[model samples]
Target: MRCYVVGGAVRDRLLGLPVSDHDWVVVGATVDDMLSRGFRAVGKDFPVFLHPRTHEEYALARTERKTGHGYKGFAFHASPDVTLEEDLARRDLTINAIAEDEHGSLVDPYGGQRDIAARVFRHVSPAFAEDPVRILRLARFAARFSDFVVAPETMALMRQMVDAGEVDHLVAERVWQEISRGLMSERPSRMIEVLRECGALARLLPEVDALFGVPQPAKYHPEVDTGAHLGLVLDAAARRGESLPVRFAALVHDLGKGETPEHILPHHYGHEGRGVALAEAVCERLRVPAECREVGVMTTREHGIVHQAMELRPATMAKLFARCDVLRRPERFEQMLAACACDFYGRPGYDMRDYPQIERLRVGMRAYVGVDAGAIARVLEDKSKIPQAVAEARAAAVADALRAA
Candidate 1:
């Protein structure tokens, strides 16, 4: 049996990128052959094994045919007769289809090296259109390699797939999985743009897709619309090295703007309140994790108020903190502020602008936490009145802190 290193490791190395993992394609190897060499079978759907020593995955060279719909509807064939070329032919992208043998001899059956040099994302064959997940993966790859562009033919093929209702079959877990990874990339906006380019964004995330042409009341930069602003926010979140929750919050913080009435034009007076429910709907639809959903919802519900923190009354600010559960969960509050900062900096010519609101919120957080709620509660005999007294004390403490400043 001959083993060839294939997929991401080889592709990343060819592009002078740091290789994180090695995926081996074992040609002319059977399940028993791998087991005899101490490889543990790990893949549930196909013949994939883990090396006993390095623990890296070693999948047998195989070709698959689309049996039905979605990504999971496929039949696999793996045997000693499967050729390396056959396996590479079934891969999604030409760049990932390259293989390197044990002697380090490169095999370029699909012109992966040429495409890599051209900084292009090209599909390998007609089979590329079979899997719906490939579209998400391609978009994610665009986010990672910010300079690379998708080939026109490949883009057209993806559009065809979308038109054929292939992407509509994608499940929520898989959609979230790919999108969350793309959100963490260096240029997360590219993922959104790529998905939009081929119309997958409209099919998958109609809420976000509806935002593109909508106008916002605030135009910090020349960015045309709320959709352009969303792209900027996503990239800004990535630039700040934010966690997933913060990034997600930055993504959906403006959903309510999409639901604005045409007569109102740019002004979305109560978008934040409307956005809270819309954001929650998106979280529920995507089945996002609780942490991400909570942060997304909070940022959507309060980002407008957060931007106006310095102007808010101390009582109002205290109510904001208390409503956000700042005393109990301060980290979530911090993430909310960070997401708001992303929204603040996302516009053109706004990166240099000072966000004094964040500092004010931080000061308020410190003062809000400094209030001895336990002490105030113990002194108050009426338990029902304790909440009101504590809230008043907290607001007063914040007022004093702001006054001293």
Candidate 2:
């Protein structure tokens, strides 16, 4: 059996990127042949094995045919007769379809090297439409290869897939998986833009898609369009080198703006509280991780408070902190502040702008957290009274800190 290094390993290597993992496509190999050689059979839908020594995945060269709907509806055929070219033909992107033999001989049946050099994302064949997951994958690739342009034909095919209702069949887990990866990529805004272009954004995340035409106060948001502001926020998150939770929060922080009453025009007076439920719905719909979802919810609910920390009364700020459980989940609170900072600086002509409110919140939280609630409870015989005393003490501490600031 001839083994060829395939998929991401070869593609990344060609792009001068770090190859994280290597996958081998074993040509002229069957399940029985692999088992006889001590390769552990692990694939449920197709013939895939673990190498006896290296332990890397070794999937038999295979071709797939669409038999139904969704990404999992395809039937994969793998046998000793399956050719390397056949396997490559079934891949989603031409750039990922390239292979390298054991001797390091390049196999470019689908012009992957050419496309890579051209900085283009091109589909391999008509079979690309078989899997709905490809749409997400293409968008993710756009995020990773920030400079690469999607081929017009490939984008058209993606749009066709979306129109055919393939994107609607995407599972929540898959949708979250792709979105989270895209959020962490080099240029996450590109992923959202691509999905929006292909109509998958509306199907998977209507809450976010509805934000496109929504208006925002031009004075506060020089970008003017809430959707464009969201894009800017996502990119700002990337620029700040934020974690996934912070990035996710930045993405969902303005969901309530889309639900603003038309009569209110661009004010969005109560959008912070309005966004809390909408952000929760988005998190629930996408099955976002609990940690990320919590941060997103907190940011949506308290971003305005965070932005106005310096101006808020100590009691009000203390209530905000208590409501957010800041002392218990300080990291989440920090993430909330970071997301708000992204939102502040995401507008046109506002990059790297100073946000003194964050520092004030940090200092205030530091001082307030030092107040011992247990000690205060010992002084108050009534257990219910202890909460009020603790809150008052914390508020006093925050007031003093703010005054010192």
Candidate 3:
């Protein structure tokens, strides 16, 4: 049996990148062959095993045939006859199809090394169209390797796949998984650009797709186009090394503006209220985790108010703090604020300007936290009045702090 290091580990190593995990392809090996060697069976659909010592994944060299829709519609054929070249041919990208043998001899049957040197993303074969998830993975790779451009043929093939309605069959979980990873990349906007270019954005995220042509007030958003503004926000979040929840919040924060009335023409008044529902809908549709959903929804609803932090009255600040449940969930509240900061910093001539609004809100939060709400509740004669009394005390404290500041 021949074992070779295949896929990302080889690709990353060839590119002088840090390799974290290694995937091995065992050619001319059967399940029994692996089992007898002390390897543990782990793969559900095909023949995959874990090394008894290193615990790394070892998948038997296999070939597949398209049997149905999406990524799940495939029939695998693994046997001692399967060649290393055949297994590499099934990979999505040429750059990922390279393999290395135990003697460190490199295998480049598909010109993966050439494509890597050229910084181009090319599909392995015509079989690339069989899996819809490849499009998302290509986009994510663009995000990570921001300098690489998709090959014209590959882009055309992906467009054809989208036109054929293949992308529509992708499972929501896979979509979320790929998109969330793309959002956290160093240049997340590249992922969005690739998706929009291939027409997958409209199919997967029509709300975000609509924002590309939408107009925004040029004074506040020097970028002028809401779609362009969204890209900037995502990149800004990435530049700041923000978390997944913060990045996700940055993604859907402006979706409400896409639904703005055309007569208003660049003025998105009341878009926040509209945005809350749209953001909530996206979170639900994607099955986004609770932390990400809460931050996204709250950022959508309160970012506009947050932008006007310096001008809001003490009562308004207190109400905003209470509504966001900042005291109970400080970390999430901070993530929402980080999302808002990205929105403000994403525009031209504003990217480096001071964001005093964040500090203003921080001052208010400190005052609100300083208020002894429990003490107020303890002294209240009527239990029902406790909430109102605590709110009054918090507001008064905020007012004093603001006045002092």
TM-score of every model?
0.98, 0.97, 0.98
Instruction: Name the top lDDT candidate.
Output: 3
lDDT of 1 by residue, 1-405 (tens): 999999999999888889989999999889999999999999999999999999999999998988999999999999999999999999999899999988889998999999999999999998989999999999999999989999999999999999999999999999999999999999999999999999999999888999999986555547859999999999999999999999999999999988998899787788899898889988998899999999999999999999999899999999999889997899999999999999999999888989999999999889999999899989888899998998899999999999887
Residue pairs clashing in model 1 are none
Ranked by lDDT, top first = 3, 1, 2
Writing each residue's lDDT as its tens digit, candidate 2 over 1-405 gives 899999999999988999878999999977899999999999999988999998999999988888988988988888899999999999989899999998899999989999999999999998898898999999998988999998999889999999999988888999899889999999899998999999889988888999998888898988899999999999999998999999999999999998999999788999998888989999888889999999999999889878887689999988888988888899888889999999998999986578898899988899889999889989887888887889899999999988997
Question: Model 3, stretches more than 4 Å misplaced?
Answer: none
Model 1 stretches astray by more than 4 angstroms: 218-221
Question: Looking at candidate 1, what is the lDDT of residue 56?
Answer: 97
Comparing 1 and 3 by lDDT, which wins? 3
Tens-digit per-residue lDDT, 1-405, candidate 3: 999999999999988999999999999999999999999999998999999999999999999999999899999999999999999999999999999999999999999999999999999999999999999999999999999999999999999999999999999899999999999899999999999999999999888998998989888998999999999999999999999999999999999999999999789999889898889888888899999999999999999999999899999999999999989997888999999999998998886699998888888899999998788888888999998898999999999998988
Where is model 1 poorest over a 10-residue stretch in terms of lDDT?
215-224
TM-score of 2: 0.97
Model with the higher TM-score, candidate 1 or 2: 1
Give each model's clash number: 0, 0, 0
